[model samples]
Target: MGELRLMKGNEALAEAAIRAGVDAYFGYPITPQSEVIEYLMAEKPEERTGMVVLQAESELAAINMVYGAAGAGKKVMTSSSSPGVSLKQEGLSYIAGAELPCVYANVVRGGPGLGTIQPSQADYFQSVKGGGHGDYKQIVLAPASVQEMADFVKLGFELAFQYRIAVLILSDGVIGQMMEKVELFEQMPRMSDDEIAEKYPWAVTGKKKGAERTIITSLDLDSRKMEEHNHHLQRKYAEIIDKEVRYELIQCDDAEYIIVAYGSSARIAQKTIQLAREKGIKVGLLRLITLFPFPNVQIQELCKRGIKGWLAVEMSAGQMVEDVMLAVNGNGKVAHYGRYGGIVHTPEEVLQALEEKIIGE
Candidate 1:
């Protein structure tokens, strides 16, 4: 346990990265998330913990820097908003193909283009469904609070290294900009060359005496070899799905109606549940913490328990609802309610939709 302090989500995330022993951070400035790098620069982790921080010329350059550092077996990270994250997709695909471990955060804004600087979960599909090319998956974690914003950085790094895969902390403007009390972790020292060698033996660090040189690249000219690599990735993803499904079920016992949400929407849905309960409506909430794993089994089990209906509340039109429907598998009716273009839905609006669309019908 560490000291508790009131902080913004972006600041918490940056402090947590320092405490998580990140070796380097390479990122470009982006709205609702610029505070992450700004804090890192002001803290001067280079002096405090020997951590390196650099502002890249562009998101493309930042992600490629991450790829390089991660390939060298260092704990590196980057952060950006939606459009910037989109630019990093190519680098992300390369990192996944090379099987490098790193953490990235997308403090998302509303988007199809350079949407708005306000909160949005429209990037859910992109984050979970392989935003870049190739058949690959990145572990996605959604934080509903400033505390989880800090906590998930540690968890993200742990998972990234454990599976040798990229991990995404998919937050939005609401969570990133909101202020809250957060308890941060203790400071951790950066890893040394010996530590990296012991931990990531296959890393493309310089070869030891009599040891074979290691190469890190995603390029495979042979089709059969590429297919084999894809199969291996699939196996790794399946294992991650089986082992790392994380979510929170609030007031679910004996409830007839359920609300499915993640990130900021989960916080809003919590209030909706309270309001609905006051009216004697039995409603519960399923808050997804690990979005990539999807928590399908938990959702399916809940659906099997004979819930009347599900309403997926999001900041986007209807991205995550598709996953909810897939999990429900026709067991019950599922509906989606959202506000787009940088707009956030109010708790009252969510409750109203729940009543009209799910409870009333």
Candidate 2:
């Protein structure tokens, strides 16, 4: 077992990266997430393992650095809040196009223009859909607590390497700032050359003295070839939906009303479920852990089991509700209850919304 300690979310993320055997970290500091960089800088695991950590000039530069390190067949990562994350979109798109492996932790804050330094989940669409451009998707993990934040760093890298795609840890400001208990395993050993070669024969390390150089590019001059490439990606996504979809159900097997939520919103839903139960509402909570390859099939199965309705509680206006609607597939009612911008809904308030619409009405 790993040693347990009280830690903040940002610190836990940094520690987890080290424990995950990340070779380098390239990122610029931003509010609510700067602690991740600060922790890494102070801890300096690079010195022990010959890893590299560089503070880039900008978010754009940071993501490009990640792309370069990832191209070299090295595990790498970066972290930032929403605004800085937005700035990294161009590089992110390029990384996606190249199908490189890397991890990005988005400690999300309110946005649209450096709106506020508070927590928000408004980036749901940006993360699950192609946040940058083109037909691409990242393996997005939404962590609800400090422990999950740390654990996802390891989980993200595993998924990244397995799928040859980038994985994102979608966290929020509150989780980044709040303190909680965490236990991290010792850093895993570095990949041997034979293991690396077996895993990534397509990696662009360098050309041998007589061998041909392998070039990595997203461009396809021929329309037919590009169409084929897009089709391949769609097929990969379909595979991911079958293999990677993850969620947690609480008291849902016998409930009438279900709360569909993720990240911190799920925590609120947990408390709201308890309150509704005390009032004899027969409410349940469905917490999504994997947001991208959404748990649509599961939701549909639940609806078929006579789940009467669903309340999508998010920190955004109405993002995930669309997915819930599609999942219910016209069989059950699905409504939205949320607090947009920087404001968060309390558990009592969420319970009230359920009473007003789901329970009483």
Candidate 3:
């Protein structure tokens, strides 16, 4: 109802950032996600909303820039594919170490090392787990459609500011490239400096007259202080786990089996559920929307409902399934199935895998 338009997922992300009142965007262009920046450049958010969009020379530079802006209480963001995101990990870690608020996106592509430009969920471990070195967690949103790709930008910023931590929108090439209808939100005014000062009293605004200078850094040379900081981060992560578990259930009331997936794989699983239901298979679909906070509680609740088994269908060799297995914890069997290295699994193939791996076997 806001403004409906057909848009590629990446373009939708750009428009959403503009309307989200983001202060800055600093990122490098990479395949499958380059449209994010291309759309921003063409639309010129500067003239529209005073948003500063800069294409950094490298992913490393871009992420560090994000760190700087976010430390000063500005809403900043960046986007990249797998490899490009890898290059930004150190900066991301630093941002996390300092407990900064910023948004990032990884339009994931196949990769162990530049494997392919095609979409893959192989980055699951990196996004949900700590990709950077440390004991920190990021709030990760997995968007299943172009509309979500747009909507999550606003949500991501909200979460980032709410918790004063990094947030990630984990998309893959499938959604990044696919065209779909999206209803975009109305524009939001950029936050003023006075508002930032009122909101983020800890931010490095500058040395005030006869006031203590604010220092922001992740570094605490003292081992005791470092341990305390880590404990603080852990507590924050636990709070997020308690409050931010988000997922969608499809035909799960009397389900004997459930297929677990996120993003594009979840989209395909919707169809697979229909096919299985037609064959009298009481299968349901659990589409996970937040990967980091993880829907472990939901899965456990399903186990309580007598779900016999689960099939984790993703675009990876097997990652999220491990988490599912942990959540199930011998309550039921958990198996993984997917087409890897950029090949998408068809609804029929997923149905077959579900039948063979958990049902038929």
Task: Score every model by TM-score.
Answer: 0.99, 0.97, 0.99
lDDT of 2 at 93: 88
**Model 1: colliding residue pairs:** none
Worst 10 residues of 1 by lDDT: 197-206
TM-score of 3: 0.99
lDDT against the true structure, per candidate, is 0.95, 0.89, 0.94
In model 2, which runs have C-alpha deviations exceeding 4 angstroms?
A: 192-198
Per-residue lDDT of 83-139 in model 3, one digit per residue for the tens? 999999999899989999999999999988988999999999988888999888899
Number of colliding residue pairs in each model = 0, 0, 0
Task: Tell me which of candidates 2 and 3 scores higher on lDDT.
Answer: 3
**Full-model lDDT, candidate 2:** 0.89
Any idea what lDDT model 1 has? 0.95
Report the C-alpha lDDT of model 1 over 134-167, residue by residue, as the tens digit: 8999999999999999999999999999999999
Question: Who is ahead in TM-score, 2 or 3?
Answer: 3
Which candidate leads the pack in lDDT? 1
Q: Give the C-alpha miss distance for residue 6 in model 1, angstroms.
A: 1.0
| Arranged by lDDT, best first | 1, 3, 2
